[model samples]
Target: MSDALGYASPQHYPAVVTDRWGRVETTLVNDGTAFGMILRGNRFEGKSVDGLALVGPPVGSNPPTLCDGDLCSCTIEWRMPIEVSLDGAGPSRVSLSAHLVLGDPTPNRGIDSVGVTLTLHLPTGVVATTTPQELIENALLDLQRLLPDGTRLLACISCAFSDYSPAGTAFIGSMACFRDRKDAYRAVSGKRDMYDIWSAMSGVVQETYHCPDFARRRPGSGYRG
Candidate 1:
């Protein structure tokens, strides 16, 4: 990009984008100064990006073999597409592809397990995205508006009957409903005194997901997540 714009020396730094697991996703490269470009001469290029091939990425540490008529036996491929929408805006599409390749019968060795390599593709310009906390809050407010005048969006996050687990949350949440045995399990959920009583019947719940067993949390309970 610098050569295209006639730059002798480049000073702008490139910012990398990554997934939650700290894996490389994409990068934002600046080629020139702001005055000569659109505030910043940012380029979103994927041609040279490693592990971008749909079949087999040569840049991978161990390039996977898809198929070899003489040396390979069976191969399987999997693909999944997900669309994410936030704040009632245009959704962004994310897709994942995987391949399971089995080598042909060998004279020297038996079939062994191989490692997995994943490559993610993101939109050049993200349309709309929000943090989990913000999304939860907004969803609750919207749900409350649709309910009756006196009703509120009561879920695990907003229920006094629910509390965090000993190991904290596992993505969605770690809170469990103790409305079944409020007295025995209300103080702390899923960890402590009610350890034995808490089972699948009163399991962990999503922070924003709605449920029938409803209970409002007290003000300043320090559990309003």
Candidate 2:
């Protein structure tokens, strides 16, 4: 059966956290958060986002080098607006998307990256399907299982030290993660540029890129994911 949309159903609000024994810590999803939030336009999103990236190990003149003086270690692209019938009766339609490009191709070509992969959530219900969150999450997790050991989805988006910029952000969203990858933020501030200056303390990592030092977002830190 399809789950009905209600005040508590959307995954936008801060999520519940449980103890090791699965005991509830807070009755409300908004507990421990600085402010309550609501998600907008999430239902229309594609169940999954497809992406591609190039990765290589460096064997250069110096040993301590990491993706320097060469093509970026990775690049990814996600195509979207791919939609399906929530009730399984209507024709599938592609969702609207934007133009995006990540990096310059390596000058040398015989070994350019070309592997392909798909990321989509599959319908989970036995007799009926809601959107496709179940389907898509399963597919993405399965892909992670097939990846080489040590490969991870670590990024600023999931890091505890990072947060959205109130002043503004990149089109997708502005986030800050210091290059050193700390266990916590060096400092929190209301000034527009304080985030940048604090980030400079360790160094600024290229936003959205695979970073050398990545830590998961702390639980109950006001982040949804």
Pairs that collide, model 1 = none
Task: For residues 137-172, write the lDDT of model 1, one tens digit per residue.
Answer: 333334333433333333455666665545444322
Which pairs clash (backbone N, Cα, C closer than 3 Å) in model 2?
81-95, 120-136, 121-135, 121-136, 122-135, 122-136
For all candidates in order, the CA lDDT equals: 0.36, 0.31
Cα-based lDDT at residue 76, candidate 1: 26
Q: Top model by lDDT, which number?
A: 1
Candidate 1 wrongly placed segments (more than 4 Å): 1-152, 187-201, 220-225
**C-alpha positional error of residue 172 in candidate 2 after TM-score superposition, expressed in Å:** 3.7
TM-score of each: 0.31, 0.28
